[model samples]
Target: MLRTGASRLALRSIAGPAARPAAPSFTPPLQWTSRLSSMASRRPQLPPMRQLTPIQGAVLRRAMVGKIDRKAEDRYQHEKLEPHPELVTTTSSVRSAFSEVATPEAPKDVDMMARVKYDFTTIKDTFDLSAVPRQAYLIGLAGVLPYLATSISTVYCAWEINHSVAGYGYFLSAQTAEQLLHFLEPLQVGYGAVILSFLGAIHWGLEFAGYGGNHGYKRYAIGVVAPAVAWPTILMPVEYALITQFMAFTVLYYVDTRAATRGWTPSWYGIYRFVLTFIVGASIVLSLVGRGEVADHIKGIPGAVDRMKNLKDDAQQALSHQEEGIGAQKAADAAKED
Candidate 1:
């Protein structure tokens, strides 16, 4: 009994715990089971694909094969056309076409003689002298008279000195010749400086008048410097002063010409200035020559008077010789007649 009991205990220990039977699950309804069975039996059917006709299939295939990006198409077109870039007519072509029409033909014959012989009156007319005001002419003539007077006085002084005359019975006298020249030299120098200053001041006036704009500074500088330069020339010798003045006048005329060319002055201003400059330059040269001639005569150098005496004596001798020759010719003719 004890052994059977021990064997039963060992069997129980080896078996550990006895399995309990699972509680009976509740059965679904007959309709539910039939629905689940039908669902299980029926395989899910996919949506039918859209049917394509032969033409449609061909279009689809072509669309897929021939799919072109717009940007790529444009790039391809540009590349394809780039090699033939000269297809379009350029502006050069158009210009060349019109160049022939615009070009003038050369003359078959040229009349150079006729061109040379062209009337000078036409050029004179172009200057429009009539356009110059009466006041301007009067003022200009009045201004020139002083220069003329000085030149005449210079010539007279030279003449009187050469002839050893004491006086001209008018303005010039041998006693006053040196004094007169000294006075005239300073007078000319002062007048030239004044005129140069006046010329420079004109640019200042123009500047103030609003015509100069940003260029007024340059004009102002020139105006100030020109007068300053002219004033120093007066301290030089009389001949040098005159030469300096002459050079200043030339520079002023050049400036005036450039201004006139650029339309800074009146249209007739250039011609007017030219005329005045010519007169002034001539007077200066005359004064210088007269001074030289007078100096030579004062030094007792052979001069105009001596040359004149020689010429006169030669003329008288020639006339006497001619009369003698004529008398001899008459005598010869008489002898031949006999």
Candidate 2:
């Protein structure tokens, strides 16, 4: 079990056991105990972990990262933040002598666009309500008041018809309230159509004034679409009209947003339209619902009754004319027989 002859001689020399070992045949008595102990301790031991500083740790991690390892302490940092990344540009001209084209200088915006790596703010910081102007906000809100009033009045009228509330009925009779509801439906639809036309006209005005750069057919086509969509809704029935207007409002708002993004309109126009469109859509939905509930309580108008009666009258007249022709033919036959 001894590694070398020196170890065996040293152990023997420390004990001075050679004097007593001569009694044994060939094996020694103290050597057997040491051989058993050495066999028991033959397994290898593990080393302890080393503690490293941040710089050393970063370097170690960097070595493990890419194929061509980066060595600079200032560079290749773990999760490094570089607000202004280094730009390496050559000042000397290297273009061919026969070439006529010259290189253009890069704009500052080009550099600004290339933000630090893994920047979340670039993606997430999109919407800010404070960017919307106060005048546009207030005016847009005010524009929705008519729609709000009509929607509320419609709901209230429906509720009034179902339950006779005497105190409130003193100012407005149930019949009068019903009449007002009838009036409000047309008013609401007409108002919505007008609003849509007005919204569309803004684009035309902007195009005429050259508010944004000349957008050509793009802006002109947008100006025409709003009025085209809105005008037809006025001719539709109450339910259909409101629904069409709702869709128109939503589509127009989306168009406005695109226009803003394209720099054809003010930056705040999208949010302004969004707030107005939301209120207008809600009002339209409320109006439709209120009208629906009220319709259940009231009987539907007998619009087809007159048409049916007119059809019967026309059939009788046709039968009478046929009878007169048959009588005349019979008379002619009798005269021929005589």
Candidate 3:
């Protein structure tokens, strides 16, 4: 205020001719208040404003200036103005899986396929089973049981026969066990043929019903092909028979899927055929593997099995023949001497 008044008086003296009472120095609408400041406690009392000369008033105004604390001002701002609203922090706890086994983490750089142990994608891809009738679905699954049973039984019988012939142990006499093992092979092969024929006959039934539009001999040919392929396998060696049936099942399964795709069979037929064929093929492999030893032994000899019992019997018969010749020679010598 004093600086303003002094500046005004100096301007009035300089422009005495044109100056009117200096219009009150312009005041701003918003007055600044120092909320963080304080006045000095001890101060000199001033004479009345009217009695004071201009110099005295100036001097008194200068003496009255309040001191501001820089530290206090900064502290005030830090406490009040800077932290008007506080920040909030939130945290979440996630639950883990309950299994004891820890999951293996996949490589970040590798594709999903690279992490897989088995390449089963081709077999895994099959049509949905919902389209097949419940009865047919159940029965179709049941059809592979004979293949499964024969395969498993053949392996057990083979092991028993082999062990028995070796004098390791016997479930039955060696002959019985051998017969039993041999018995399983023909059943497996003949059963495979019958199944193949039955599956082909389904196409025949479908054609007769004209479930899909007749395509001349195309469908009939499919029916004939399965039985043709199946029957020849019965005459094959056990190993060859099993391998042939496996291939036949696979090929017919492909055909069945193609028929389904062409709308000749229900959409579910492909999946049904896939399941049955998978089982049958596995069964054939199992049977072939079980008979592997028989295959090895039978080479260069037709239906010949070497066992301890057979060897012993041959040795005993030769010994008796030698003893008889020795007795006959002694008698001839005694006669010649007489």
Candidate 4:
């Protein structure tokens, strides 16, 4: 029993040393700690925003504008804007050129045709109106001059009519001549109106002719001369008889001339004279050769001829009536004496 007790005491002492923990093992978990630290260090960080200073912001804004890129500031800048866009100003050459070509108030001709009659303040509107009398006079003269041939024809016709008829018929012929003369007044007025209108058209046309340059100027000059030369040559016969024809030709000539002076294109042949001459000649021939039937409703020469014949017939009839009355009275006296 003594031995067994001693053994127990030894075992107990050994067991007592084992009862306390060894204060954790001597080494730590190095791999796990290192891995955690590395993970934390490797995580991405955000970049801080860069805010602009107020002064810098204002400078950038100003740089975007055109106010600082002025023409005087840089010739290069000015050239860049030319084909693109630039503000129109009084000094702009392009604008000035456009205005010169477009403005009506600006005169283009060397002589300035609008100034031909001095002092537009008093004359322009009345110029046409005042010209009426002159037109009337010219038309009347034209109509009257052609009547010479008609007058001879009329006297011959009248003498024949009187021989065939008597006194009252002669009186009728005289009255007809007076009536026809009265009708001529309106014809004169009509011719005057045409001339006045033509003059006005030509005046305005010349004002626009300057855009054609030197070649255009030459073209215009020739165009104006063409009509002027043509109408007068063509209307020679008409001017001698029908004032209306003269007036029409004159007006057309004036318009063509005016347009030509203004740098307008001329028609083919450059002359209307042949046209007028042909028209007048044809009309005169028709009246003189076609009998009084052709004279009927025909203006100018034909009408004039008809009027002359009527007048002659009236005079002859009156003379015939007087002769008849004298012969009858003498016959009655002789019969009473027998």
Q: Give the alpha-carbon lDDT of every model.
A: 0.67, 0.73, 0.70, 0.44
Candidate 4 ranges beyond 4 A from true positions:
1-302
Model 2: per-residue Cα lDDT at residue 90: 41
For all predictions, the C-alpha RMSD in Å is 29.8, 23.5, 23.0, 29.4
In model 1, which runs have C-alpha deviations exceeding 4 angstroms? 1-119, 165-173, 212-214, 297-338
What tens digits encode model 3's per-residue C-alpha lDDT throughout 1-338?
23355544433333224334777786444433243223323322233555555765566566446677899998988885443122311111111456433334423464546426345654344445666789998887787797799999877766765676554335665456556667777788889999999999989889988887877598999889989998887766666777888888888999998998999987788888887888888888888777775554333211212334567789999999999999999999999999
| lDDT of prediction 2 | 0.73
| lDDT for each residue of candidate 2 in 41-115, tens digit (9 for 90 to 100) | 862221111344454444444543444445664365766665432332242144557854434443344444345
TM for every model, in the order presented, reads 0.49, 0.51, 0.50, 0.22
Candidate 1, 270-324: lDDT as tens digits: 7877877888888888878887877654432233345578899999999999999
lDDT of residue 198 for candidate 3: 93
Candidate 2: where is the Cα deviation over 4 Å? 1-129, 165-171, 299-338
Question: In terms of lDDT, which candidate is stronger, 1 or 2?
Answer: 2
Worst 10 residues of 4 by lDDT: 43-52
Model 4 per-residue lDDT at 21: 45
| Local accuracy of candidate 4 as per-residue lDDT tens digits, 1-338 | 12244333333333222234466665548987787777658532211212334543344344434445466677875565333233333334334554533333333334445356556745554333333345544563464444333434444443433333432344455345434433533343334334334434443454465433444444445435434544443333323434444445555555554544555533311133223334444433433343343233334443444566878999999999999999999999999999
The stretch of ten residues in a row with the least summed lDDT in candidate 3 is 86-95
For model 4, the local distance difference test gives 0.44
Task: Give the lowest summed-lDDT range of ten residues in model 2.
Answer: 43-52
Candidates ranked, most accurate by TM-score first: 2, 3, 1, 4
Count of clashes in candidate 2 = 0
Choose the strongest candidate by lDDT: 2
